[model samples]
Target: MMESMISSRIDIIKPSGIRKFFDIVTQMEDVISLGVGEPDFATPWHVREEAIYALEKGRTNYTSNSGLLELRQEISRYLATSYQINYKPETEVLVTVGASEAIDLAMRALINPGDEVLIPEPSYVSYSPCVILAGGVPVAVPTTEKTDFRLTSADLASCITDKTKILILPYPNNPTGAIMDRENLIDIAQVLRQHNILIISDEIYSELTYDGEHVSIAAIEGMYDRTLVINGFSKSFAMTGWRLGYAAGPEVLIAAMTKIHQYAIMCCPTISQYAAVEALRNGMDSVKRMQEEYDRRRKLLVHGFNEIGLECFEPKGAFYVFPCIRSLNMTSEEFCDQLLKTERVAVVPGNAFGDSGEGYIRCSYAYSLANLQTALERIGRFVARVKQA
Candidate 1:
């Protein structure tokens, strides 16, 4: 009736900014949603077949708390071979229900009450709430479009305070599509070491980079011991619904995360773990192909935004584009609502991420080519009408 003596913190939590737009758009049956941050593709046939085969073979029961041994080993090998991220399957890896659970586990494992976790602004909405729910404080560090929305060493250095215990680094970031390159990562690592801050690097979109490559901060010397790497098949292999992901870090940190996960999560879905293993073993090709398609759409969106009078940075990774809508003289929310009301194209306002996101709107390019074309035209017309008004 009253959420069973719910904690005051829970009451203070706002619903996800990204999710709130869904209700508005869903009521309009004809609207095209470019709002959610997920791939539009289905899990590949081969991966799905593996899951079906597992269930058909009567493999429906629970697996180990960490995960099926084979899946953890496969993920260990995949990270090393693909991204040069070395992890020990036995002691350094823990599987959970998607990267979201991993984020929660990491916060619970590392944070003491009143500890501060630095999260970059305009990031996924979950970071701050999870920090607060774990009795930790969230210190938001703003990243601007001038830097391609990528968090830099200066930003990291400026945000570090004595109470800071963790930093959630969501790179190949959502909404902005910015990536931390080898150099930026190394510089940030230096600052982190200086402040003795632990890093929770969210690399779920590692496989989606259109830049040279996705480099894990954990791959740097000495950084591995201080970094918890969160990754999953959701973005890379189009397996969002399967709800499988894992974290790799030092044995001590990983063991703590495993303990929390064992009690709270038990294990990831068994069938999904089987499929994720297949993905790790032989799914690089699919990732490469999908990235190529995303690259094409990324270029198209950048060009379309510029032509339509919105200034946007070209995203080097991930599938979303953040376009500045201040020229319309309306807030991001006003712009998105007006566009949706008249043209039936749904997008998320930049402030959905953080206060720093006020004058922008995030449009995901995970849509089909035809849908993107139509959405862009509608947005263009909306811009023209706003100018005239």
Candidate 2:
């Protein structure tokens, strides 16, 4: 039997809900997809042109195991000025394929077999699997709509056991769109310090916060020494395809991650590093304009869902809304599949994110306004039809 030859670990994971929706949406015509995680905008013209110029000049080889010095310096400055996190670019940062790769690298570098990784539930799909692959167990702590989906320090404390080696802090979070304020972060930092645990802080959506400015755990006293801050151009600069991201932490940890990067990716795309420098230096204007658009869409979708009788939270960060649909008496998967087959509007089932996501569905507002309005109309009709029967 192939079971003897194939690794058992591979069977523990399956195709992702995000990937499943993507496959169906690609085959369907005229589908209004709000399930996408990437920004709808193109990379700014100047940023794109930088990559073009780099290619024309024949700078197409690997830069370094880490990344170009100029790009890393730009990232250091960007994080310092924007979030007040001080990172020495030369010793503390390692550029990776994307934030996705950075997450994988961080888990692989830090985790050991039988160690536990404390995670907040209803988060991005990658955290748990990456931990599993790293030979660590995932300990998911659920967050709720009552708490605005913010994972509190007490939540962190309650989840801790002696075997817990790391905590994955994903704020300005995915799916639910919740964000933690400074006071919340300080309290969590205290808990982390008390337990002597490390943190993998994924701030990929840092620039996309709407209610207030983004904050970093590393900015707090005693936090920098124990935190790995992950960021990239994909969310902020409309540069998802550029596939460039970086991790900043202690020199020892960054070195371990860089060794993995050297063997696995060798180097991030050279052109992307050039484009990211432009993005970091001149991309704020583009980010502001894009955030404005997302805000408008956010308001529209939240209002639209409520108008049609779906109770949902107004997300504080990122571009998604997690709407509770238990009133319809259908499971999240059933609702999503029926909606897709009937109205051709693709939104992901909440259960895809975690157990706390049941009875809900997640919709990204990263689509155009026209599509949002059309999706609303179709969803409204569908809801009416289902309720009538």
On residues 243-317, what C-alpha lDDT tens digit does candidate 1 reach at each position? 988899999988899888888878888999999988878777888888898898889988999999999898888
Q: Worst 10-residue stretch by lDDT in candidate 2?
A: 13-22
List the candidates' TM-scores in order. Answer: 0.97, 0.96
Q: Would you list the C-alpha lDDT of every candidate in the order shown? A: 0.89, 0.91
Could you tell me the lDDT of residue 240 within candidate 2?
97
Highest lDDT: give the candidate number.
2
Considering only N, C-alpha and C atoms within 3 Å, which residue pairs clash in candidate 1?
A: none
Query: Where's the lowest-lDDT run of ten residues in candidate 1?
Result: 14-23
Candidate 1 residue-wise lDDT at 210: 89
